[model samples]
Target chain A: MIGRLNHVAIAVPDLQAAAAQYQTTLGATVGPPQDEPDHGVTVVFIELPNTKIELLYPLGDDSPIRGFLDKNPSGGIHHMCFEVDDIIAARDHMKTQGARVLGTGEPKIGAHGKPVLFLHPKDFNGCLIELEQI
Target chain B: MIGRLNHVAIAVPDLQAAAAQYQTTLGATVGPPQDEPDHGVTVVFIELPNTKIELLYPLGDDSPIRGFLDKNPSGGIHHMCFEVDDIIAARDHMKTQGARVLGTGEPKIGAHGKPVLFLHPKDFNGCLIELEQI
Candidate 1:
């Protein structure tokens, strides 16, 4: 089951501008941008009191975020992450119940250096859901 | 500044079916459905350990969610809600920084009986953000 609301991700055309908006306008602490080669995206974290906001920009043409942005030129909410105490159990449970996990259907090292799995949006009511082990 | 993440709203074509997925498959605690005529949507809350997930369905033809669902028949994330210590201060600060607050630029009573204001997605990296005074 889902634990904490880890972070909500937004795909942005300009990562720096998005980070600046959160830092200057919202007065939030923004972290350095990191390129996730495996995910093919560059990401920055905007720290909040209770959770974080992740700003993502496509790193390469193969980046899935690029496809999302191509469909929505203005960018949009990309996906939401929820923490889980045991991600393996959660994935197994979801799979047994007919949920489709993206990629190889196995956990992959995420931007946070934790094992994460992405659930298909079709199975999750059109919202892409990411599960990360804490 | 944003406090704790309140809830992530998802527009669903069928509220009951969506709630059932969370309840039966995900094993989340689902709340009773409530109709918000002011927003022209019916909503249900799925309680999580750290935050809640709101399922929204069109209450009438005028419901804004109708348009979203018409484009995404499968349903998807509508918006995200973050708790703010002072709604008015946050609104003023956001406005001063050139962030457009949706509607009349004033907080309205949301489904949780809290004063909430929506920010324009275009100003926030294409993510529709809702700030609630908590």
Candidate 2:
């Protein structure tokens, strides 16, 4: 059901500093920071040859990233995303298998403008799994 | 400097159950578990179309993963590995940029039999980063 590894998301306290480290130190090509209101985070994509690295920061006080940052003051890996061919079918498959989907259990438009669903960390052995339809 | 995302490692309490979840529920092709005494972890790789997911469990009492699991009883994403064309160059660059390389700053043979070095999480926004020569 899962296709390619889409991107790995990292929650950061300072998005600019984190993006700058990747750009300057790692010599990586980073995209512009984008606000994802639905996901309640501002994200920047660091382009890689095979996959991308997403740097995320809280969009608001109530943002989930803010909560994550609160627990991990230094920031941390938030989630890992995998590509799926058919999001609806993937969601149904996950649901039938008893995996809890975050939010409304429906697909949401993600940073790549693709339909995405987040699987509960508990179900995936403490790692939040994001499935994106490519 | 990084070539591709090699894999994302998740520290799990039960390696067999975690591997089974990916194999049966997610319908992924999971490889057999292998012991890495040097790294002090037993790992299983779940092959995906684009990148692989590595499930890790403590190999001994002094295993780093054991400490991680103690903090997170359920399991969680431990580290993300990126491929580098020249590991020595990558290591030098990371060192020049003031990034702390873990374990005596030497490259060790990783699970894929590749030269690998780990960067401290504090330097990379709290996400443990591993660079492996492809």
Candidate 3:
């Protein structure tokens, strides 16, 4: 079962502007950008009292968020991550429920250095979901 | 300054099906749907540990979500709500910073029975932001 709402990832064309908007305009605490080569993206975290908002920008040529930004030029909510106790169990449960896992159905090290798996957006009312083991 | 993340709103085509997906598939505690006539939305609250997820469905002929669902038939993330201590101050700050507010730039009673204002998605990297006074 999903425990906590980990973070909402937003793929942005301009990461700095997005981060600044939250920091100066919204007056939230925004962290510096961190590049994750494995994930092919750069992330800037906007910390809130309860949850976090991750501003994702394409890092490498094959960055996963690049294609997303291509379609959503301005930027858009890429995915919503939820924390789970056991990712293996969660993946298995999702499988039994006919929910499609994005990548090889295995958990990968996410940007936060945690095992995470993405569920198909089609199966979740067109909303991409990431299950992270915490 | 923004306080807690009030909730994340996801517009779904089929309200009951979305609720069932979260309740049974994800094993989340989902509340009964509440029809907000003023907002033209029927919302189902999916309670999480840190925050909540609101599943929105069109409730009236002039439902605002209808346009979004028309574009994204499968439904999608609608908006993210953040709580602020003073709505008026937040609005003035946003205006002074050149961030456009939606509607008449006035706080309206949101579904949660609190004063809420929606910020222009264009100013926030294509992500609709709702600020609620808490």
Candidate 4:
């Protein structure tokens, strides 16, 4: 079962501008961008009191967010992540409930170096959900 | 300045189905729908450990989310709400930084009964942002 709301990922058209807006305009503490070639994203974290806002930009040619950016142009919320205690159990439960696990149906090491699984958007109120083990 | 991420709002095509998905599938504690006629929205809250997830559905003929639902029939993230200690000060600061506040540039009573203001998506990486007084 989902525990805490981990983070909300927003795919942005301009990474530096988004970071600057959060820092200067919103007065939030933002972290430096870290490129995750495996995830195909260059991410910056805007730290909040209770949670984090992740600014994601496409990395390379095959970056997953490139398609999202092409469609949105101005960018938008890409996905929401929830923390689970046991990922395997959570994945199995989701499967039993007829929710499709994205990718190879296996948990992958996520952005935080934690085991994570993505559930199909269609099964989750059209919201892409990432289940991260915490 | 922004303090806490109050909630993430998701506009859904089917209110009951979305609430059921969060309650049964995600194992989250979902509250009953509360219709805000003035705001043209019916909302349900899913309580998370860190923050809340707000599921928004069109209330009547002039629902604000109706336009969003028309574009993405399957539904999607509508906006992100962050809490601030002083809403007027926050609004003034955002104005000084060239961020346009939606509507009359005044804080309206949000669904939570707190003073809140909406910022134009164009200034926020194309994401709608709501700032509420904590």
Which candidate should be chosen as best, given DockQ against the real structure?
3
Model 2, global lDDT: 0.89
Superposed by TM-score, candidate 2 places the C-alpha of residue A97 at a distance from the truth, in angstroms, of 1.8
- How many clashes show up per model? 0, 1, 0, 0
CAPRI grade of model 3: high
Give candidate 3 regions above 4 Å deviation: none
RMSD of 1: 1.5
True contacts kept of 4: 0.77
Which numbered prediction scores highest in lDDT against the true structure? 3
The digit string of per-residue lDDT tens for model 1 on B22-108 reads 987677889999999988999999988778889999997799889889998999889988888899999999999999999998789
- After best superposition, candidate 3 residue A9: deviation in angstroms? 0.6
Worst 10 residues of 3 chain B by lDDT: B118-127
- Per-residue lDDT of candidate 2, residues B1-134 (tens digit): 67778889999989999988898778788999999888799999999988889999999778988888999989998999988889899899888998899998889898778898999999999988999998
In model 3, which residue pairs have backbone atoms overlapping below 3 Å? none
Residue pairs clashing in model 4 are none
Number of residue pairs clashing in candidate 2, backbone atoms closer than 3 angstroms, sequence gap of 3 or more or interchain: 1
Q: What is the TM-score of chain A alone in each candidate?
A: 0.94, 0.93, 0.98, 0.98
* DockQ category of candidate 2: high
Against the native complex, each candidate's DockQ, computed on alpha carbons, is 0.73, 0.81, 0.89, 0.82
Off by over 4 Å in 4: none
Per-residue lDDT for B4-47 in model 3, tens only? 99899999999999999998889899999999999999999999
**Reference-based TM-score, model 1:** 0.94
